[model samples]
Target: MARIRANGVELEYETMGNPGDPAVLLIMGFAFQMTRWPEAFRRSLAEAGFHVIWFDNRDIGLSAEMGGLATYTLNDLAADAAGLLDALGIARAHIVGMSMGGMIAQLIALDHPRKVDKLVAMMTSSGAPNLPPPTQEALAALTAMPMQRTPEAIADIAVKAQHAIGSAPNLRNSAEVIRQNAIDDFRRSDRPFGVIRQFTAIQAQPRWHERLGSITRPTLVLHGADDPLVRPAAGEDIARRIPGARFKAFPGWGHDLADAMSETLANEITAFLKA
Candidate 1:
C-alpha cells in the first residue's frame, strides 16, 4: 500500500497497470476503503490499457484520521481528489466514481473540467435531494447498520444489504462476496463517524442542476435498476441535465458492487472511455 501525503492528509493508495498508460481513477462509495475497488475490477480495467488508481479518501482505510468531524463540503472532497492527481503528477485522467465518490467526481468534472477526459458516475446522485429517497425498508437497512466486529451483526447487516439491493434471482449469487466484504470492512476500519462526516457534506450540498450544464466533459451515468439507496431516477436526472451524457441501467444490481453485473459496468466504462 503506497502512501502519499497530499490534500492535507496522507492518502493510502494503490495503482494498477503500466504507469505509462493514460489513467482512470476509481473512487468508491461511503464507508468504503481504497481496497473496496475489487482487484478483479482493477485488473479488468488495467487490461483495457488504462492505469487505474484507487485510494482511500481522508479518514478511510490507512489514510490519516484526525478524529472529530471535518469542516468540509462536497466541493472540498472534489478538491482533495484533484490534489491527489496533482500529487501523482497527472495532468489529466478519466474519472470513475460510485455513490459518494461519484458525487465528488461530478464536482471535479464540473470544477476542474480540463483535468477530466471522461467521467463515469455510478450509483450516485447530483445532490438532487428532490428525488425520492430510498424506500423505508432500504433506508432503515442502509442507514441503520452499525460498523462493528461481531460476526452475527455483520452477517445480519449483509443480509439487509442484499435485501435492499433486490438482486434478480437468476443472476450470479453475491451473498458470499457481500458477506466477505463486510467482514473485510470491519477488519480494515470501523470509523463509522467518518461516514457521518462525509454524509454531512453530502446532505448539505445544494442541487447542482443549474451547474450541470458547465460539465462539458464526456460523461456516462451508470445506475442499478434495482438500487434502493440511489434510485435510477437520480442517474436519469444527471444524464438529462448534462448535455450528451449517456446513461445505462442494469437489472439486479443494487448499490453494492458484489453484483455479478460488474462485467457489464466495466464494459460500458471501457467503451465510453475508449470512445
Candidate 2:
C-alpha cells in the first residue's frame, strides 16, 4: 500500500515480516497485480523466517501506467524491479518470479548479478521458439478481452480465464472465491490497455534464452505438470540451461497459483533459499 519511485516510474509495493530478516522479493507476471501473489503465500514465506516483498509492476494496479508509449521491453520491467530494490536499500535478496515475472527475474539475475542471492523461476518459459505453445483453451483464456469494462463483464472474463488455466478442479479455489477475486481485481484497476501493452512488451523483448548459462546464482525452476499455458517442458528447459539449477514439478498444479499450492510452494522455496 506504499509507493516508491523506481526506474523512472512510481511502483506500489508492500512488505511483510521484519526488514532485518533475509529478504525475498516477489515479481508477479503479465497483467497480474501483486495481490495475485496471494496473501497466505506471502505470509507463509514471512513466517518461515524471511522478509517478503511484493509489488505491482509498472503500468498495473496502483503503479504508474505508461499508456503514452507504444511498447516497452521486459528489460525495462526488470530494471523497474531492480530499481525498486535500490530504492528500498536492499542490497541483495532472494528473487522469485512467476510466469512473465520469472522472465524478469532471469533478466535481473543476468543484468544485476550482485543483487540476487538466489533465483526461483516458476511456471515460466525462456521464450524458446521450439517449445510447445499454450494449449488452445489456455491461449484463449490469456488472449480473451472483456466484452465490456463493467465490473461484472471483467469478472466474468477473469473467471473463465482462471478456470481455463487453473489447477485441477479440486485443487483450485472455490468458484465463489474465484468470482469474488475477479471482481476485486476489476475494482482495483480496469485498464485493459495496460495488459495489451505488457503482452506487447513480452513479445517484443529480444530472445535471451542462451544467456541462462551465465547466471551463476543458485537457481530453481518450479512448474506445474498439469500446466497447459506454459508446459512443464518449458520449466525443465530452463533448469537444464541454467548451470546448477534444479527443477521441480507438481502433479496436480497448473498455471494459476491456487490456494491449495501456496503452503507447498512456500515450503519448497524456503528450503531452496535456505540451502
Candidate 3:
C-alpha cells in the first residue's frame, strides 16, 4: 500500500506488474474500497502485460475524507483521478471504472481527454431521466438498515445484500465466499458514514447524457442483463450515445460482479485494451 498527494488529498493506491508495462487505472464503484477490485482480478490484468493501479477514492478506505457535508461533484472526483495520474507520472492510462466510478471515468474522458486512452464503463449509467431504475428487490436490499458493527453481523448483512443483488442462482458465488469477502472488507475499514457522503455526492451530480456523446476515446460498455440496480438500458443508452463504442451484456450477471464472471471480464477488458 502507498499514499500520494493528489488533488489536494492523500490517496492510497497500489500497483501490480512491471512499471514499464502499459498502465491500467481501475476505479471502483460507490462506497467501495480499492479492495473491491480483487487481488486475483488485478493479477490477471497484470499477467496480461499491464501495470494495474487500484486506488481508494476520496472518503473511502485509506484515502483522505471530507470533513464536512458531501459537497464535491463527480467532476471533482474526476479531477482527483487526473491528479493521481499526474502524480504517478503516467501520461495516460486505460481508464476502467464501475458504477459511480464509471461516471467519473466518463467525466475524466470529457474533462481531461488527454489523460485517458481506452475507457471501460461497467454496470453504470448516463444519468438520463428516462432510464430504468433499480428493481424493487434491489432497492430494498440497498436501503436495508446496517447490521450490528460486529464482524459476524457485518458479514451476514453483506452476504444477504449480495444475494439480493448478485448474479443468478446458477452463478457460482457461494454464501461463504461473499461472507468472507465482507469480513475482509470490514476488517480493512468500516465507515458507513463515508458511504452516505459518497451517495450524497452521486445524488448531487447533474445528468451527463448530453455530455457523453462528446467523449471521443475508444470505449467499451459492459453491463449485466439481469442487473437490478443499473438496468441494462443504461449501458445500451451509453453505448448508443458514445460514437464507435461497443456494448456487451452478460446474461446471468446482476449488479454485483461475482467471481464466476471475473475471468470473462478480465479477458474482455484485456482484449479491448490491447486493440
* Deviation in Å, model 2, residue 151 alpha carbon: 1.2
Q: Once model 2 is optimally superposed onto the true structure by TM-score, how far is the C-alpha of residue 180 displaced, in angstroms?
A: 0.7
Model 3, TM vs. native:
0.97
Indicate whether candidate 1 or candidate 3 has the larger lDDT: 3
TM-score of each: 0.93, 0.98, 0.97
* Model 1 Cα shift for residue 136 (angstroms): 0.9
Q: Point out where model 2 deviates above 4 Å.
A: none
State the C-alpha lDDT per candidate: 0.81, 0.92, 0.89
Error of 2 at 122 (Å): 0.4
Q: How high is the lDDT of residue 102 in model 1?
A: 94
Count of residue pairs whose backbone atoms collide, per candidate: 0, 0, 0
TM-score of 1: 0.93
lDDT of 2 by residue, 153-252 (tens): 8778878888999899988887788888888987898667888899999989999889888999999999999999999999999999999999999998
Give the C-alpha lDDT of model 1. Answer: 0.81
Best by lDDT: 2
The order of the candidates by lDDT, greatest first, is 2, 3, 1
Provide the global lDDT of candidate 2 against the true structure: 0.92
